[model samples]
Target: MDSQHPPSPDSEQQTTSRKRRGIGRIGWAVLGTVFFGSLLLIGILPRLSQRSELQAAVKEASTIPSVDVITPRRAAATTNLELPGSVVPLNQTTIYARSTGYLRRWYADIGDRVRAGQLLAEIDSPDTDQQVLQAKAELAQAQANILQSRASLAKSVSDLKQARANLLIARQSWERWQVLVKQGAVPQQDADTKYATYQANLASVEAAQNTVNSDSANVKAAQASAYASQANFQRNTVLQSYKKVTAPFSGIITARNVNTGVLITAGSGNSNTSSSTSNTSLYTIAAYDTLDVNVNVPQSSSGILETGQTAQITVRELPQRVFRGKVVRTSNAIDPNTRTLLTQLEIQNSDGVLRPGMYASVKFAINRTNAPFVIPDSALVVNAGGTQVATITKDQTVHYQKVAVGRDYGTEVEITSGLTGNESLIATPTVDETEGLRVQPIAQTK
Candidate 1:
């Protein structure tokens, strides 16, 4: 809009300087834009590439399942087999009266230790005492009868001697008469009377001899009666001795069924001939210097049990104490009903800590020639096919192995077959797991 004018040198120089300054500013702005764009491309491209690589790795890992694996370990050669047992005394019995009577006094009681033949109680048997007195009186009467019979025998002998003298005198008289009659110096009637007198004397002598033999027989009968009376008296005295109850063996009394004045009957209360009766036994004695532990061993382990095998016994009441014992006997024959062997163990109980009728556990250390492999219970895969275990191969492939189970140890199970104890086993296989399944095996710590 202004009028055209001729340019001056100063104006042209100023214009040129302004144009050069604008061109320099444009070039610097273009260089700044190029440098900032290069920096952004360098930072964003690396982030995108790393994100894509991470996504690919995650996708690949999701296809395979991670499995926890464990190496199989061999079980111990000698394992402790624990079983239930019942404790009892080595010798136990119930004492009863041998004679029927009333209890008079007691010397021993429950928990009293006594020696053999020690008196436990006394019985008052008036009947036995009276019988003994009667037997003695009868024995005395028999002895007196024997003495009287002997006196009678002596009198009979004296009579026999007198009769023999008379017989001799009569024989002489008869001979004199016979000689007189033959010589005609005496009458025949006088000879006949002399012969009759001789006959009478001979009859008296014969009667005296018979009386002497009867006296001798009476004396023998009296002596035999006296011997029988003596035997009866001795038997009564022996019965009286039985009135005193005594211990048959050295033991501790466990029960007292009778007190003073209680009527007791003869015979044993524990005899198989009768059922159990109350107040029948005077006392129950048990020998506890040694204790017996009875246990029924299972059939699987019974074959290895024998006498003299060491055992360890523990009771719940005595938790801290471990009683050591040995097998004393075995039934040898198995019980078909229970499929167990009755085994008895004897333990020294000098301290008297172990008692009868206690529940206890017995442990036996059984050594095996071939120990089976053991695995966690979770490793076993039980199904319709059979018992199996999930194992991993070198290429991380799952293989189900059939295994024969031996003993069940609660948390673990014994593999009697199908394992060499060198395979890697899956600790906890899932239901989805199958044979020849590819998995990522991860070793477990335990």
Candidate 2:
């Protein structure tokens, strides 16, 4: 109790603090006001101000000058269209073996020129030769049989003659005997015997006639056999010639499939044992002096292509060389699958410079027309609608006129329609320029 009065000052202060709460109401209110004010200014106000400034910039840039300037002028041009096509030979053929035989030798080979009826190769037909010999033997046997039959016929004829003589002598003897009997110089029995002898002689003469007829028939049969044998022998000899092979036509030997000692099977049903063996060709020949190119044209362009049309062919192998040709023929019907017309072009290659199966490009000029307005391709502006050329009117204003374009030259285009020749055409136009825009004209320097 003694210090209580003095401690009163500091103690009284501590007691007073305890009596109050954790924070004052005024301090809480002030903190809440400051947080809400900062959120509004930092987040919402800046977005509003930025949006206004962006809108202002957009409006300002929209009014800026857009395009550069270009002048219009006129130029002369020719219109021609280019078509894609390949070069081809006019004629081609593949050769195959016709007969089966051992390839004896090849006289002609690839790249060798051959004439019509020239021997291409020979076959060793030992089998065919043996068959011929066998046929000849059979023929000789037939001839010998014929000779034997002829000799038998001759003997029969002699016998027939002798029998007729015997009959004549017997008849004379019988008549003499009969006369003697009647004159009482011969006996009756003897005259009867002479009559019997005369009958016997007549029978012998008839028998001899029969033998002669048979012998004549045998002789004819033998002659026929001999003729048949001769014919067979001749056929055999012809078959033996199959060993030699000849070219079917005059052509160069473009292919050789067989070499010496290669066995070639006879083609078709020809028997190797027959007198005539089928001659199998060992080399294939083709006439390459002329070349043909087959082109498939779309149906749309088919109408313009016809026989005798002029064409130019360029070979890929020989790029610098261009061969002149004409449309030799065409398949009048269009192919359904490809919807293309088949056309053929012929070119002469007498020098043999153009080989078969070489790739080539063919160009055909289908239509040619005079263009009223022709200008350089650089002047054209292509958009979604169609092609157009920027033209300058007399009032010095630029306008885009839609135009129908025809053939295209390397640097120029043909205006088929929608343009008058008198209008000034722009050689170059700026993309930023719009229709109806005023432009300053300057003559283009060629």
Residues 44-64, candidate 1, lDDT per residue (tens digit)?
999999999999988987899
TM-score, one value per model: 0.63, 0.49
Off by over 4 Å in 1: 1-66, 133-235, 268-278, 316-320, 334-338, 392-399, 436-440
Give the number of the best model, judged by lDDT.
Answer: 1
Model 2 misplacement above 4 A:
1-89, 125-244, 267-282, 293-306, 311-324, 331-343, 357-373, 393-397, 441-443
Question: Which RMSD values do the candidates have, in order?
Answer: 12.2, 25.9
Per residue, candidate 2 scores C-alpha lDDT tens digits across 50-90 of: 98888897776466433333432233333222355554544
Measured by TM-score, how close is model 2 to the native structure?
0.49
Enumerate residue pairs that collide in model 1: none
TM-score between model 1 and native: 0.63
lDDT of each: 0.90, 0.72
